[model samples]
Target: MNKKRRLALAIGAGVAPLLVVTMPVSSASAHGYISSPPSRQAQCAAGTVECGPIKWEPQSVEGPKGLTSCSGGNSQFADLDDDSKGWKVTPVGSSTSFNWRLTARHATSTWQYFVGGNKIAEFNDNGATPGSTVTHQVNFGGLSGKQKVLAVWNIADTANAFYACVDVNIGG
Candidate 1:
């Protein structure tokens, strides 16, 4: 090859590798989880509780809507379903706030809070997009002591929903 051709080829080879390395990888588009009154995944992320893969990906416990599990039915995060995992329970009053930290905000349908088999609170967004942070005041009427609260974030345009479980000591 000529000198000019060899120089161009060498530069092309160097730039090709960088272009490939900088390319974005496909990942889940929706990411949000309870932060305050830290959810199981949050606890795992914070190292407050020793956990499995969830420790690395606390906001990725996503599954189909209407499922009732801390891990969002994701087997990789099934450790969140283990009640004996010694999750730190946050103490709260009768009515308290639950906060969420969103990494990728998507159009939301509703935010639901459930205790036991019954849904205690729900806030509908009507397909509106939310900010990076969201908070809701939930009243735990007639409920007391240690309780596991399941929070679901239903995406407006998809069948999937993000799930988080918050262990709280109400009236403690």
Candidate 2:
């Protein structure tokens, strides 16, 4: 009953699945790097939302745990795909009903949501006109117990500058 086993058990018994994967907080600069790979399993507790493991160059590096923000823009919980691009698959739980939300800044942007590499939904944001935040919500359909939910935000092709990304795994 080491740490990992204990964590797995705790998560299984909890209301929502736990994020068991953890990544290094700091690392050297690299081009087109992934802040938090999909392996870092994290839980989305009720009333608690966790941002993504962001990856970007040095200057725009500003966020929780030294997660860098892509310069010139920012997007949070924008799901990513298998290619490590801004589109990935996410699993869901047997709960069957949930709301997936995303937040982004800097002009108009697109937020893409997917489950197991399939394009399931999309969100749009037209930057704030009066210093307001842009938030998008979509229904979590066809999700089952112990499923994965991958949410991605496509800030801009020219520059990465993303805010955050997260996957909420529900059920025991």
Candidate 3:
């Protein structure tokens, strides 16, 4: 090979890996999931809830906001949208802490919780990346009985939001 060609090949090999490392992919990757309260995805991961593809990758439940479907708006995990799936309800009071098992920590914009289509709690992350695990205390207000809670983790840098649908019984 020519000297110029050999030099170009060597430089290309070194720079390619750096480019890949520096560039973050925009696609969704497994990051955060509500583990303590056993969110729909968590229950699937734990085998307590028999789900489709979601059983393999629970933390990958992510999608943009404005869409009110479970499974983070991903049709692949549409099983989570099924209310008849017999999701186990975690007994909780008016106030309870929601724990997040973060695998790939990202700067967060906010965390929100909604029940019966009404927002019960919302907290700002202040554009900070959370720890490996994050716990947010949420007040359910006057809500009672079995209810479906939608938890959202809005990414600060991107337009995507990781979602976790938690089923809970407000009182014992």
Candidates' RMSD to native: 5.4, 15.6, 6.9
Model 1 lDDT on a 0 to 1 scale: 0.91
Give the alpha carbon lDDT tens digit for every residue of 1-172 in model 3.
9999989998899888777655433222458899988999899988997998787778888898655667888999999999999999999998899999988899999998888778889989889989999999998888898999999889999889989999999885
Residue 53 lDDT (model 3)? 76
Distance from true location, Cα of 37 in model 3, Å: 0.9
Per residue, candidate 1 scores C-alpha lDDT tens digits across 84-163 of: 99999999999899999988898999999999979999999999999999999999999999999999999999999999
The per-residue C-alpha lDDT of model 1 at residue 11 equals: 81
Residue pairs whose backbone atoms clash in candidate 1: none
Tell me the whole-model lDDT of each prediction, alpha carbons only: 0.91, 0.35, 0.86
Clashes of each: 0, 32, 0
Off by over 4 Å in 1: 1-30
Give model 3 RMSD, 1 decimal.
6.9
- lDDT, candidate 1, residue 15? 82
